[model samples]
Target: MTEMTLDPRQLGTGGLFTAAVPDLASHEAAYGRRPSGWTRSPLLRELEASGLAGRGGAGFPAWRKLAAVGAGRPAVIANGAEGEPLSRKDTALLRQAPHLVLDGLVTAGEAVGASELFLYATAESLPGVGQALAERRDGPRVTLVEAPAAFISGEASAVVNALETGTALPRDKAARIARSGYQGRPTLLHNVETLAHLALVARYGAQWFRSAGTADDPGTRLYSLSGDVPAEWVVEAPGGASLRDVLRLGGAEPSSLAAVLVGGFHGAWVPAEAFDLPLTARGLARYGASPGAGVLLALARGRCGLQASAGIVRYLAESSARQCGPCMFGLPAMATVLERIAAGERAPWLASEAERLAGLVTGRGACHHPDGSARFVRSSLGVFKDEVRAHLAGACTAHHGRV
Candidate 1:
């Protein structure tokens, strides 16, 4: 596994992964103990005022998720299942700053009057998280479960499913996790990073939480920066940070980039021309991208974007839960077409076929798996139009043999 790297200068002061806080004792010493005894209303108000959004993609307001579980003995889950292949931020946080996440989990449980608390994470992160839990002197007991390595396992519904049914597949969309979750209780599922931010918000209040980022997007976010860089680095960036600056922080030269796949395998591509834009949802909207889980995969100048996209799409297609026709049939079909296109298929209708298949699979799954895969495929077709053309003409313009 690639070791996660951090740069304090890029993180600014009081960022999540500080050098001062390595162990549980150091964590409490640096940030002080988490203040206890919060009720629903005040906590929700503070979270709303903080303008914090979910870091686990979808960008939903954190307060809204909490509020949705109103008037119930809800379950709170700290989700550290970093299933995205390019994402290491959650894992890094869980390993290096486990106490902070534990504090958040306990804090959220208190605020919501939770009946039970759970911490779900990747296998590699379990030992550290378990150790951190052992060190806590006065927090609510938290149950820890090892998360499966599948890409879809981290989806909100899927996380609930895994704990309840021992299956990592996503549950039906009709039953929202907040309304009906594990063991038929209202559950407040938050990404581990989101929970960590909640811990800070609980301690420092909304204003302090909002001190770093923009008015619309407050607080700092950990970005998993990789591809054509010196190494995979998990760098903390302020919300709505410039994409170019983030890549530079990861040691990527702006000029050498062909494009970036913002978000993870399910995300869209933004060409090099738009690298200067902010990483916020609003900033990346025009390019059909978002800061989904803060995953930024840079495409070097000589790489074949279509080939790179095809491989990811193929992986996503195979990663499907297969409970829906779109995932079971449509995604594989779409992947096959995309793979053909990447392999320099001269058929004039190949590109259109891929689009047709994307349209077919989109929004027709039991989950958003098909939709996200479609978005990735569609974005590739648009961003790599030149490459598509070259491949159709029996040539690969990127000259790297394969992307």
Candidate 2:
């Protein structure tokens, strides 16, 4: 598939708006060099003080992450592993604006006093990033590492683990990769888009960068909008913009809306009536959701929310590495129950089983899979209670025995 070109200005400072870059070659020229303003810039310090969070789903503070690996011969990992099937923004950015991404990685390494740069990407994305890196001979020391294609393998720590051990798998502990990553050296891991933003911010300074986004969360973000949307493409928008605005940008029909799933499979389902809600880490939390990886799956009115939830559950279950006991046993059982429920089977007890499984998996795994799965399933039950009740009453009109 030919990669779409995005306008650098679309990635510009005015909140989230569509800008087209056209193609890779054009984007490289636009990327040029690190903005001279970044030299001796205190933006990283301000970003730390400003509490800029990771846009790559976790929402962890960027400054804290950088601070975690204080001045040293640290290594920087530009995590470009876009694992969610629904998310294409990261890979799209890499393929289209590889130079921008490379510039960000180099600038970030320089900011944190890191000497080594490792750009970790899925095998599918390796070629694009590698080519981009090859064009740059004046940047910081760098290497491109291809990670295995797996769902959870793209998590920040997982990327670090894979780079160090040459294994594309998540570790069995909540290991702080910043403390000891990449040959037991302090490492700073960030999403490709996040670093790209850093490159610009480092050049423009915080005030100039802050002019485009919300006060609390300053900057633009890329969202992957799909399902029942007319304009199903990656969108660039300002942080804390209303969800309604994003939906409109995606060209979603008013009648096609039912509930919108913010975040990915691990996110929550908010009724479409609440589309006016702002899109922010804290705002989504008010609705019992996190913008996990910036995926917005809009379900149409006729679509069965429970069945949709079931399909996602099955996917998450199958994606599990099976390293943790709770995730191994609980996710499969939960998916089975969701499958039965989606099939219109009268398994009232299955709901209880899902709840029980959620309890077991919430915080018991080495990774966030179990927690994420629990959130996905638990939120489905909460959001689709009426549907579950209808299925139990043998009156489910959606997906009757289709599973």
Candidate 3:
């Protein structure tokens, strides 16, 4: 097993985790009393005006998610299930600021007139969350569910499935989780980081929330940085931050890295030349990368990028829920081909075969598992093309094999 080195750091002043909000009183002191009496329409307007997007991989508008639930009793979930292997921001947030997350869950519940609220997180975070719940006297009752240590468990459908059934595998993708989910009720699920941000938005108002980040991408974001850095850190930075600045915050010099995985295991790769690019969807679109899950993994210059990508692809293939043909067969086949190419297989057909397999699995999974896995593998091939050529010539261009 790979060792998880999770250290939390904040970029500027007054952002997430900068305050010591370990318990309820401290949280209240830092953020003031939770703004109450916010109904659906009003809350939607506030979120929309705030321009807050989900900190989760998708970056969907938070207001739209609440509006989608429509009327009737809804279920709200604070998803702290940080199942991405290289991501630890959610776990750090849950441990350090559980009350804020709980407040956000309650805020969302109030907005949707939700009948049930759940805070689902990994075991490492449950104790703090449970304590936060115990500390709270006002607000709707929140049930605590332990999240399993599986990659796909953090997917929205899988989260609902985990609550309905013991297994944390994703169900049908066609079904709209917002309309019918978790015991066939309307469910609004937001990542823990997003909810924490929402909690801040609720208190600070839209303009105040928009004050930090760029006009296009508003508010702050929590990023989990690792891979060839001096240390693993969960850092908070303004939205649309430059990758170079983020690396510097994580104790890594951008010049020393060959490339950086902008997202997590299921994310895309960006060459170091583009390190100056903003960590936003539009900014990274050309590179086939985004701030997905707010994960930035630095690949040091002398490390074998292909070898590192191959290992991650293999892990993703093995982590699949295996509920659909793409996950059950296509991912493993893709992984095998990628591994062969990374292992100095001289065959020219290897790269094309990998591409073919990726196409076969794209958009065919029950969840985004197969698609994300394919994305990672395809990005590896594109970003490490030079390495691929060297390997095809039965040689390696990396100064060292470490990644």
What do the candidate models score in CA lDDT, each in turn? 0.84, 0.75, 0.84
lDDT, candidate 1, 177-250, per-residue tens: 88788888899999998988898888888998888778867888888988877777888777777888888777
The candidate, 1 or 2, that scores higher on lDDT is 1
Across 1-403, the per-residue lDDT of candidate 3 in tens digits comes to 1122222222112344543437777667667888987898988999999899987788899999998995667899989888997888888788777887888899999889899999999999898788888888666799999999999889999999999997898988899989998789899999998898788778878898888788988877878888888878877777888899877766678898999998898889999889888989899998789897888888998888888998998898899977789888988898888888878888988988889998999999889998898899889989899898888877778854311
State the TM-score for model 3: 0.95
Model 1's alpha-carbon lDDT is 0.84
| Model 1 ranges off by over 4 Å | 1-21, 400-403
Q: What lDDT is reached at residue 11 by model 3?
A: 19
The order of the candidates by lDDT, greatest first, is 1, 3, 2
Clashing pairs in 3: none
State the lDDT at 355 in candidate 1.
94
Instruction: Estimate the TM-score of every prediction.
Output: 0.95, 0.90, 0.95
